[model samples]
Target: MTTPLTPHITTPITADLLRGALDLEQTAHGVLPHRLPARARAQCADGQLAMAESQPSGVRLVFRTRATAVELETLPTKRVYVGAPPRPDGVYDLLVDGRPAGSATVTGGSTLTVDMTTGTAEHRPGPPGTLRFTGLSAGVKDIEIWLPHNETTELVALRTDAPVGPVPDRGRKVWLHHGSSISQGSDAASPTTTWPALAASLAGVELINLGLGGGALLDPFTARALRDTPADLISLKIGINLVNTDLMRLRAFTPAVHGFLDTLREGHPTTPILVVSPILCPIHEDTPGPSAPDFSDLSDPGDPSDLSAGRLRFRAAGDPAERATGKLTLNVIRDELARLVEQRSADDPNLRHLDGRELYGEADFAELPLPDRLHPDAAAHRRIGERFAALAFTAGGAFAPEAA
Candidate 1:
């Protein structure tokens, strides 16, 4: 038997040791492993940064960086959200080098937000102010805070708590993942429990969380984001929200998905990409989503009841033959992804796909009944995280030890 390679571990960091000037570019920023809250009192105790969380009831955190400028990027890795339902008004924040530079706010009532913040910045929130750091220096002496709950927060990470030393390069490997709310981390106990963060930790790779709440429409913009990002390994979790949101027509969805995948190929070239469909949702499994007009809001013409059925937003596998053939249900998406990868595999050895149900399905659902009967809870998040590690990062998986 061969020996397992031991990773170079660093000394534990301390706040007292972090005091001084630092550089963000030259030194490495320790990664945050889980989702954390945003309240000062709560954050002071937990000290974990919010790596990712469900959208809408969005999460935020503060980072005290010594680097003169900071950059924030989103990974396509996903999480699902299930709660009292997050407010459409939710937004994500970014503090540069130390000061609040820019923020991503919910716009046009759109449920998706993805943008990278860079350059010098300052505090910009108007009320109920969050912690603000003054001028920051450079060389990795900084703290990153994570805020999961509107009422609670946590301190997540630091670059220079330990003694200053030559920072080793944390090789660049993009981790791309996509999925519904569970991937969006709907009701996870804390932000960190989300599967994407957990998987990234075990793999030791950069993350790009693209899980959108009720908005993974497979839209071109989303495809654009995926296509543009630099990824070493990619995974997509489809289904769930499409069914839950009852957003589209089957006819329109088929091509949209094909196009989305096509776009991603344009950018990644040869990087490994995984496409994942949704977990099992009993409410919409065999039933068709409600598509009649939502009387409450004429602008929102789609059937509100459809959202409750738990089906993909745009398409459904209504034909028995198609279901048998695996056409348009969550399973259909999974199968189609497999087919896509198979067709492309001959030319692109990097393409791969997996079924979301493999991660969590009927039996798992029985163990963890989602509060909303739609999204998974914190326990489920842990289960999903473990499952992902087994498949995506293990020695037997597609990626090599380092790439994972």
Candidate 2:
């Protein structure tokens, strides 16, 4: 969509016009947003967290504009896996007056290709791409350009046919959510389609999603990040990352959970906090995790001769018997989390626990199985989001209007 460049205005993209990011740092080309502050990022030695935090899962450029045309210059980091099929282009979703208006994806940007066998990555830099949207609805309205959830993007410039300004406060409560890849929208169609984003829209709340892909390992820096961030509602989806990474044994996990909660409570003594357990993942239900990729056969058709189409899958690699020696499994994690919440709820009345299975369980699994054997697909994402809104933001829910 081409808009006349003459008489167009350019708006310098800044932190105040952004939402869902913890901090922003000016870069040589533009501004690089961070989901974790500098202090928390400084504590990280892991490369996965570094990549995840910079992805900006829930970040967006929000403003009020009457412009019928808008263009944004961005340099997005796209990921590629060696020996695997190409991934889809990252999507940028636009909303006008709180409804989806359009979507765009640029063809050219920087690429980071990873060789899984060698555990090595190669970066190929490219020029910035313009994400342009035209024919927007008329009248001054709140506009949101939701960033790609899985790609790291550096904002360069914002141009519009008409002037745009910071959106006025809407007085809606802000919800801060932290979790793993599934929460980071691994297979969801777009950024706004992520479960947390969907649920936030359903409940009419602002969102700050810290859903770090492969990085939600109960790090103290993460807890501290949550502690310092302002929020009216908070939720932590635990277990999947810990179980998959096989990070800690039961004894250590118990204290770590308590310590993480303690740190959050220091900053938000009475905030409504909801701790969620892992959802129904059959592979990790009884078996200890330490999950590994299975490139064997995802299209598991039982036919004798048709075996040409197969994709990457995942499976639990740890010994199930290890649970006797204090290893963690999804089922055990759920039980432990429930018990801990019950015990702690006696003193912290505002704290609550939600069984993740309630969001996606056996029956749903039978209907919509996880295509990758781990992360739920886009359809499942919608179901989980709807269930979350019903359970967490409705009448008897923690963040309900009446509850507040």
* lDDT for each residue of candidate 2 in 1-404, tens digit (9 for 90 to 100): 75544327999988879999999989888998899999999998788888899998999999998888899999989998876667888899999889899999977889999876577888999999998988776688899999999999999889998898999889999999999999999899999999999999999999999999998888999999999999999999999999999999999998999999999999999899999999899999999989887644434565221223325678799999999999999999999999999999999988999999999999999999998688999999999999999999998887777655
CA lDDT, every prediction? 0.48, 0.90
**For each candidate, how many residue pairs have backbone atoms clashing (under 3 Å)?**
62, 0
Model 1, 95-182: lDDT tens digits are: 3433344443222211222111121222222222222322344456433322332222122232222233333334657676655556
Error of 1 at 154 (Å): 16
- Candidate 1, RMSD to the unseen true structure: 14.1
Give me the candidate number with maximum lDDT.
2
Clashes of 1: 62
State candidate 1's TM-score. 0.57
Candidate 1's C-alpha runs over 4 A off are 1-126, 131-142, 147-169, 290-328, 402-404
TM-scores of the models, in the order given: 0.57, 0.95
**Alpha carbon lDDT of residue 339, candidate 2?**
97
